[model samples]
Target chain A: MNQTSQPKLWLAQQANRFAPALFFIGLVLLWELICRVGKVPNYILPSPSAIITAFFNVEFSRWMIHLWATLRVALMGFVLSIMIAIPLSIGMMRSQLMNRILYPALIVIQSTPVVAVAPLIIVLLGTDDPSRVLITCLITFFPLVVSTTTGMLETPPEMIELSQSLRAPRYRETWQIRIPYAIPHIFSGLRVSITLAIIGAVVAEFVAAEEGLGYFIQFSTSFFKIPQAFAGLIFLSVISLLLFKSVQWIQAWFFPWSLPKKK
Target chain B: MDQAKNSAYVSMKGVGHQYAPQAPLVVKDIDLDIHRHEFVAVVGPSGCGKSTLLRMVSGLLIPSQGEVSVFNRPVTEPRDDVGIVFQKANLLPWLTVRKNVLFPLKHKYGSYSAADEKRANELLEMAGLTQFADKMPDELSGGMQQRVGIIRALLLNPDILLMDEPFSALDALTREQIGFDLLKIWREHPKTVLFITHSISEAVLLSDRILVMSKRPGTVLDLIEVDLPRPRSSKTINSPRFAELTDLIRGYIYEPDVPA
Candidate 1:
């Protein structure tokens, strides 16, 4: 018989949670040291500490403002995408004529580079929040529509039979059988869209906007505040991460039964 | 009420179907009459269009040639009076076991209330899944999931039950268990059942009559009456009479390859 296992082994395994942050800390320390030794000018290569100080001291309020602006636009675009996508997907599923007419146009919309089109949109719609939101919607809309339509159409034949035999109304079948079956795929598309939304907002801001993380980055570079520019980059990344995580959380919360439990 | 005592509840008149207009007909000249409270089993070899015929009767398919009438009304599309249990459990993975049972009721009633919840709980309890009500389909064993499917079908209190190979996926032990459960439900609620299967024992153990069908361009070859008493069990399987009937059905199914 082996001796009782030490509880410290379990504690050691739990310490894995901090590994990535620790690794990032170590890299930052090494980069700071290298920059100091190399006597790199702040304009050329600001140390990690300088970037952090700039982020905290000078840009905190502006960062919050810009982050909120981008998030608001992105959120509005995402909600609109969901509202429009679901019905369009359902319509496409109900009619092959609708699919034939709309699918090619959807392909064209998805394939068009959002970044290249942002300038054109800004010119057409003016440099307003709506234009930015439109660009965001453009970028994120197709995936949701395509995935949801595919999901609704691909409902298990047996489940369809089950619904049919119940004499379920067409609307009821669409709601209970078709939509619920499509949820997993719909969530997958939504996860992809969350990040695309952020990218879309940023690209639109890059083309035309007086406020937002994209504008902050643009202005910080003009003023030669390289560390503050990097700070803006950090803000954008954090926004992207939070958006992605929020979608994951939403998917998990609403569809607890559908999700595969993690080991 | 007395008229319902004798005539067929479901009558199929010259039903024929094909996958496409140009394709060879899969089910040709099928005429079946299932009386009220009767258990009819359609048995055939694979690809023999037995399942296709059931679909037509259930109104999942429209026959190219003939009419299907349930309770003397044309079955133009699916009706709520009929419940279907598919070969697989086919429960949506996203809904809990109880929710799956409540699915048909939701379509029937169109809203949720405390009453619906109570009924759902009752159905789950009846299915012996009281503890697993919140469990998703993927979390349950295959036999357990199939039980949930059965309960879901019964929740509607349909006038007829259509089953397409409902137990063919289960192991022998599980199949026997479900077969008995089905019989108990049938006894408790006398619905006209049209069950499709390939197993001779399954058809024998459950059906009032077994309709044996021949292969492609499928047609009913024979109708064998199962005069076995009610509440038949595994003990009944050991009886000489049960064995004789089972053997007779088996011989028909595996009849010496008709010199095709």
Candidate 2:
């Protein structure tokens, strides 16, 4: 009975491994059918095949340029957000008064719709990459601060006791115990912030931009370049997925101690 | 008076601790003096502030009144010479057993060198964890992780070790194994130890004297000396004397009116 059961279990495991790829192929086939049968207007909804064809046929350099623009904004905003959040989190953890004072302000900032702030920031800061970066930074910064502070503050009492009994210096305790303890949470916040940063950059570009995926989308839609617009949308999604996945990968690689970093 | 006449390695005089001003005391009017190299266990029924007393000794908590002194000096803050282990091994999951043992030393002294590696390995060997040195905390069993934690404490070569119900989390068999390992380490290193546990058998097996406490606001009820010989084993638990001491301590723990 055990011998037969082992082979059955192996088959079940193999089935699990093949499920996702099969589902994705099935999805593509269904999409192709909907485009063929429904005869949806190309201007409103481009066919999957046409979008894929345009994606590869388009001048590679032109796409690279757009990719560079979005990547630059995303990376810049992510780095800026991290710089602002880490120190703020440390401050909040160090003093309860700081948490009491600044945490509410942070909630207010986070709750404010990024779209509402986008035009205002464009108006105040002027139409440039700085405004886009600043908007991305604003969208991404608060959550990281909140999560990092929560993580640092949530260090287990036993770990803290261990450090205290060791007579560890204040800074060493923070760096070795608190910071490392907070890495999983911080990475989770950063993952969300990274995707948000990309969205923020695009939205900021929607208000005022001569380049970037948002501008490309706008230009394609106005010109009735429907396939190209869908292709641009596809590119934007890939950028987001890549950014999110890369952070997830980093989390897995470095902070394997935690439950797979929160998506 | 004869006990007091012995050299006091660690002393707590009338120590009282309260969580809040309006709240009741957690531990109160506790006076204790441990001789040099003494293995003392503080035992009481649950919530009797046995753990709180060890916390005071470990410098993790400040008493609301009175003093805690180690080696004749008042403990103002956590002393580098004091080592503590909690019921939870509470090891950093990110670190291997070796790294966690080296964790305290790295902060005390800057940088990890060949000397640190040697010390970590030596500690691991002492804890019977040399084979598991490279394993992460999560990878180890509960008993193994606690062993790593004990090694972490010994890595610093502290003058005294404070353990609060450190074996309480493990199963009976593992707990018994660790009890023997603890005595072996204590015999080799010869540090003043203040071990806290709610278990009567554990106290009987491990301590030179067991300080039993009343319920909160907890105060020391009695300090019973275990005249049992050195390096006691799990088998010695069957001995008539061991049974007698166990009953003596167990009597203090149970409420007479409660259903047995």
Quick one: best TM-score, which candidate? Answer: 2
Instruction: Please give each candidate's TM-score.
Output: 0.90, 0.93
Q: Which ten residues in a row have the lowest lDDT in candidate 1 chain A?
A: A1-10
Residue lDDT tens for model 1, A35-85: 899988888989998889889976467767888888888998898898889
Please, what are the lDDT tens digits per residue for candidate 2 over residues A1-263? 69979988999999899999889888988887888899987777778898998788778899888888878987899899999999999988888899899988988898999899999999998998898999999999987997898898899988888777767678888998999999989988998999998898888878898888888888888899999989999899988999999998988887788765344
Looking at model 1, the pairs that clash are none
Candidate 1, residue A36: Cα displacement in angstroms equals: 4.8
What does the interface RMSD come to for each candidate? 1.7, 1.4
Q: State candidate 2's TM-score.
A: 0.93
Q: Which candidate ranks first by DockQ, i.e. highest?
A: 2
Docking class of 1: medium
Off by over 4 Å in 1: A1-8, A15-45, B1-6, B71-73, B112-122, B131-139, B255-260
